[model samples]
Target: MRSFTTIFIALFCLGFVFGQTQGNDVLAMGRKVKKPKILSIEECKKIAQQEYNLHLGFHQKDTANYNLLKGAAITDWTIYLGIDDLPFAVEFLFAKHGLGVFTVVVCMRAERRYDILDGGSILMTEVLKRHPDAEAKLTISCLPQWFDTLRNKGYEVDERTPYRLYYFENLSSHFFVVFDLKKNGKREEVVIDLYNGFIQNIMPEWKTLEDLKRAQINFKPEPLPEMPKPKEKQEPKGKSSFPPEGKWEFSVTGVPGFLMSDLGKECAAVACTDVMIYWDNNGYLDDSDEQTYANDFCAYWGTNGRATYSQIYSGMPYVAEKHNDCYVPNGGGIRENASWAEAIQYFEALTQELGAQHPMVLNDYWPAPPHANCCIGLYGTGDDKSTWRYYRYDGINQLPQPLTVWRSSDQKWRPTAYVSGYCVGLPTVVWTSPLKGDENIDIGVQVQIHFSKKMNTSSVESQITITPEYARSYQWDPEQTTLMIIIQNPQQDLKFLTQYTIKIPATVEDITGKKLDGDKDGKWEGSPEDDYLFSFTTRGPKVSFTMVPSTHIESKTGCPPPNVQFTKFSRAILENKERRPFKVSFTAQESGEGSYELLVNELNLPEHATLCTLALKLTFTGNYHIDANANFSESIQGRDGIQITAPVDASVITQISCPNSPVPDNDWPDDNYSITNPSYPTPWFIDTESKVGILLNGFCAGMGHLLGRFKIPTVLVNTDLRILGTY
Candidate 1:
């Protein structure tokens, strides 16, 4: 009986071999194989352990070693599924996924070979979230083709909505699903297009709901049995706004600013703090202060200037699930494991304050020491990437600092390689002209509102209320991203010398229906606490000032030698023979509206030489230009004709002529370089220039150049100007 059983088993083995001999590589070739059953991580690791050992043996014998997988070796038995939802591959993690993720695909077949995938690919994490009972086929096609093969296995990609857009409005959604199941037989996959709206199909052959309607495929199924309500009454649960239709996007006001230096190179934490401050101020969290939040965040994540991406979601993501008070749900961030262009767009949106107006922490992988910074804002007009404006908040002295570009994804114009770390919070308020507390503004000065995103014009217009009400007309830019309010002079024209205030309530919302986050606490309340209230003083009808002639004299101290002298012997010798500091002294009254001069030809004098003050003239002007009521000193430009200079253009440097006119009375010309003179229609200076301080350069022996430094005369426009109107 035992011999008979052995013979039967041998015959079964021969039959399997015979089936493969017929040119079909699949083990169950002519037979229908059920969809591979979904298994837990433990089950998959156990199933793939044998293959893992085989690869380990091969790595040992690979002496010639052409493969350049440089990292810590791997021996984990992990399985990953392709688009068809079948486990046909095992991963060999070198250090971590994406850095050196080696996959032995088609492992059950003799033709199996190694393949690589991006470390940040969503596929690594998407496996468990898939429908456990998806209808699948055991097809023999390679990767890209499998995307096409998925259709045969009862799965179809909505061509209208690309897969990359899955994160558009729904960060936690992996596939399209129909909420109404009462009238369905077998459910078909539905994909929501962020830009094009939602598309639900009832049949595989039909492309849209309209097609299904035309085909009469809407057979009525029994209604899903609804659960009965309890007899006892209870407080209604918070109605979730998720999966309502599309992504929940918003723009917050006042994206807070912080320097990495303030927190010890923890840009990720500091960036988080910016958004947190906004939320805390808006009553989202009960926190101590920004510094404490940042310190605690960095300490919890162990983000010692590294692991930025891992630090975001695990560190401190701002969302509804994390903080119930916040409006958006599911932690409010998109689940994107992206690099290159994907990463670039993520940070770009963060900078543009479009889509998700969240504070972003991003990486610069191309730099020798790859680094990251918080992207606080953007300053571009059109579609040009070159024109797009994004600035680094960390290490910047001001909020509008220049964009810190580490690399470009294309490896041209900028460095190549980047890692998109994480996104949170939001951005609003592009900029405001005649900034807060600005003075000398024209009575008819047009107020410009550049929103963080395209706005709904009606919402913004209805909310605008100017103080000391004046007749005004509105003109919107072509993109609806900027609004200009053209102010007309009052009937009495007394608007001059008065402070004007433009108040925009927090009720203004963008095209996406996200109200302005007035306080910029990363949340929207539409309350007065979030209102955008900015004020600027108008120029007086007559502007005037006189030069107060004076002289300045000083000596340079602690000026180091030209070269490095930190060596022990060098420091000892230099400390004993250090030269005495040189003297810098000068005086000025007036030269020209757009011109000034210095007299530095007599520089043969020894350093540290004390000198008597030189004579200067005083002048006043309210005709062609406004005079700065201050004296110019040449103490900066120790010697030479560089004492006085023309302040006409930002770049041009026309030095005062060498030979002095025998008459110092006509020393300077009369040309107005003053920026826009309000209250006076055409006062020599155009109504579109920066304020000019009529300062003349003088002598100074200091190492630093006074080339771009000068007295910018601000008009003493009325000190008692008051804003007396609101609507």
Candidate 2:
């Protein structure tokens, strides 16, 4: 063996040559070769010590001193080694497994002095290929020089302006050393690239240490106000110390009148006006002047100044409609006979359900004048008698104050009179006859309008109209709750299969002067232009057939007469059109040894003649007829041999007519028969070869024949004879 140094050099040269050959092969194949195993922590430490001449005493003592910095999946591993008594740390990164070193990072603390000899240099070919910014041959370390240069520039470097070393990624050989300078409350950061030995960038500031100190002295603070001292605690009061605890009061606002001087005299109208305003604020009614509402209410109730509870109740619905609100009244004197206790219970329940206080009109009958005012609240008084407080509006004041009244000894409350009824909003259209989109309606149908409450007939009549204008008469029920419109002598019977619409204009009002709430949306859908419309279609005319027996056969050779069948069919031919399909069928029953033949001429059928059985099913397109010839041959042996009856000749005339007209007679050839000579009629003959054309005149043309003339309207008809004979 050669010497140790010579042997190492020879082995390295041979391995390098082999790696070059293998790399060429990998490139040609467009594939990577298998990577070698990663170096162990001890192996990396030993290499660092040998290459850099470093005394890594603490790192060599334990495996914990070495930490593996894992790279991205595509990159390789980097090992960080921390040594004792050394100001700088070392990072070893490998490329493509452990084939070779990618880069090395020497990190130093802020107080430590940096040296270029701290870490060993390594070939950065692989790292530079992946990152062009990496240096292939880095000769000098700029970290220590950078601090010296900052000192030479007369800048202070202390704990507040500390420095840190950062290694961004394993792909590059370069790293950044960041220095932070503090002055006043602001920080100025400077970055220096160590690989190229150059300062990357800096944030500039004009202030020096002395300047910052001067600025700090100029700042001053403002004084804050002193807080108040606490007070002594106190106990809660007992319920008995005050009035009854269960007592509740309503803050119902009062409304003054526009026309009348004393709203107390017109309390019903005033209370209603106030309630309307309250509902308007709650989104139930539209806003309007209180005085205007009062005037309208008074006029609607037909009262000069004072109005009855019934009148007020009746007029509220109109107010609700006009304001686009709903009004619901307790009908039929519900509160008129209620006692004091019952009245209080009713008010309590009502207010609780409504979730708010409402002004109520009081009728005091016991007070002679039966004065009316608004009841706003109720108090428990701690006795059998409750105190009822009310707001009374006298024309002079805008907002009235509440007045209290104690219950009478007889248990009656103030307003000593019985509690009268009240009304809330409820506006709607109850129902309509010939409901929306109804079809096949009778031409003479009477349109009916039923409202939730009695309507003003005159107003409704003026607003009601029909499409395709027709003469009509209006009639109202006794209560004026339902309106009936009778169509009189309508033009062309309301036009067959035509749709007619009935519209009620929005201007139509109820007995209380409220307009129709067409859509029930709590708002009027405007007037005249936006009306409620409903439509219906009238039934089309009908077409049918009425068939009468034109011929019948009597018993022949003691054999029972054969039965004949007739049928008719009809159908609509087009959409909404009166083109109906018409069909007629005639079938004759067969007797013993008898055959029937039917011949049709000038008829819209598939074939002219049919043999074996007397059956004919014919269809017609319009007003047209078919001439049917029937022949029957019956063979019955008796004393007389082959006794055959004369062939029967008959004519069937089908005529089509209008729906309102009768069917007219269709002309046919006259019968020319010599009864005395007993000869066959002209144009009537018997075929000897087929034994057909045997006319049974005894059942058709001659005397004692069971046949008669008939007619049909808008239909198809058929008449013929069936002969019976003995052979």
Candidate 3:
């Protein structure tokens, strides 16, 4: 860790000399200084407060305007905070302002080593014992321009430097680092009192060009892979299929390896797009014949020397000729066996390079079938460690980000993955439009692949069953030789999502050979080749339908939020409609002057049935008409119309009506409020000379009740709304 920090400090110093030049009296006469004396926790706090106050300067207000530090639980006794981002605020007590902040993970013990790099202390030692060949290391990489924005705004960074080292002095062994940028081609070192993780003094160091170079070389290394031959080529007959126009759905399986995979141009005939492939490893893949000693490194391991690369070139001809991305597995591939810091570094570089247009796929589905499972990665040793693992594409829509801790233990991985910025990697079937031909003719069959950072279990890889639900009666095509699947998401896409992850499973085999088991055990298990593992989603047919007496109108007093209420309602289900039946229930609110009516149109049915046929059965089908009507109070009246009618004035009794046809209900109110002024100057009613009067206006309020019921023309679908009383 110390070595990496040293490297970062060295690189940071070069920016000022090569590009810009600035002068500052504070940085003049810079010279390397000796280490300062240690201070108590209280002394550290006071220094921090003073510097913060000075930074605030005239902007400082009362105590209410004081700065607050963000805290993290690193251990039992020590709580770390970040206070470097406040430039506008003044720190009355400190020496100067800093551009960065550090998060110190301390323990309850009062004393430990100052600098020793094996791990940390006895606590870390015990934890390191779990990971056999792994060693604790720190990373010292810098955030780019955009990320620098947040870093400058006070975000704390982890080990990403080579200068950093574990030192043991006095009582405690701690990992310490200081960051200070210089303006005159010199380095500034801030004396941070290690006694309590706080800044104490500052000194300028004038270094020879040679010294600067040495510092840079001492800096931390970027988690990157060895650059491969540029301008790689894609395989011919690329895996993905692009349709000419319209809504075309396609799926790809077994894309060439990254080393020889080519991302085809947009104008290419067969375009091979970039996709994501999750790399994972558990001890199960290690056979006794391959390695003499093997423990589950997935559960524990920490090391820097394990960094290596595998050149995974495009294997399939379709991917080799058409696409053009040659992937180096170790460098560009997901690094699970490395230390957490190494994993983080690897992912950061990989994701930044890949950008968008990448797809993620879980090649090896684990934990067995029937039961759902997901995976996670945790970093650090002892109590200072954290878990921020989740499987997700860097920038995917409607995806949940990962959480540091378990939110729930639900059987479904959807909730955890969806909620935690994780991407969904469930296998799906892409639905393309039905081809025009004999109903018996088969268009195409394909499987949709989703990349997950974590697989529920290896069970999915055990056995897979792809079966048609309602189409079971048809003479289905034979399996295995007739169809096959391909996997294609990218390597970089998976690397960033895992922390402390292991190597990916080498071969993904389907235990089931596309056969459906009546007992539902078609899922793969560790069995003989009698069954082939196949993964697929159940699909169904599309249908549409209409409801009769579609309109329902209501008018009542005492309304609530969605104010308009219907005291009387009626609906007519249309007969001879081809659409399926879906149940819909609605209630309206009635209150104050805020009353407003509601109308639902084309509400979609939920996908609840495993079989499309069952979905058909659940919905109302065949020619049939049904009318639903109910009256709640005498104060409510009913009338039929083409649209919802608004009441002109308040009244104790109100009537609402709906149409009798199968059309939807929102079109209902015209009939109830269509009374015209009869006193108009028509040919027969020449009332120009005398004062004329309207007939319906005078008794409009009580006309409905007095007439018993208003008989009006009914349309296929209509509704009327009336107010029971004035708001």
Using TM-score, give the best candidate's number. 2
lDDT of 2 by residue, 137-251 (tens): 2112334456656655555563234344433221112244455654355566654545323332232221232222232233221211121121111122342222333443333
Residue 477 Cα positional deviation in candidate 3, in Å, after optimal superposition: 18
Cα deviation at 286, candidate 1, in Å, is 26
Off by over 4 Å in 3: 1-213, 217-283, 289-727
Model 2: weakest 10-residue lDDT segment is 568-577
Local distance difference test scores for all models: 0.36, 0.40, 0.22
How does candidate 2 fare on TM-score? 0.31
As a whole number from 0 to 100, the lDDT of residue 147 in candidate 3 is 31
lDDT tens digits, residues 124-202, model 1? 1111123222111111111123333345445544222222111101111111111111113564543222111211112
Off by over 4 Å in 1: 1-19, 22-112, 116-430, 440-444, 451-463, 478-481, 489-497, 506-516, 522-527, 539-727
Better of 1 and 2 by TM-score: 2
lDDT of 1 at 281: 62
TM per candidate: 0.28, 0.31, 0.21
Model 1 has an lDDT value of: 0.36
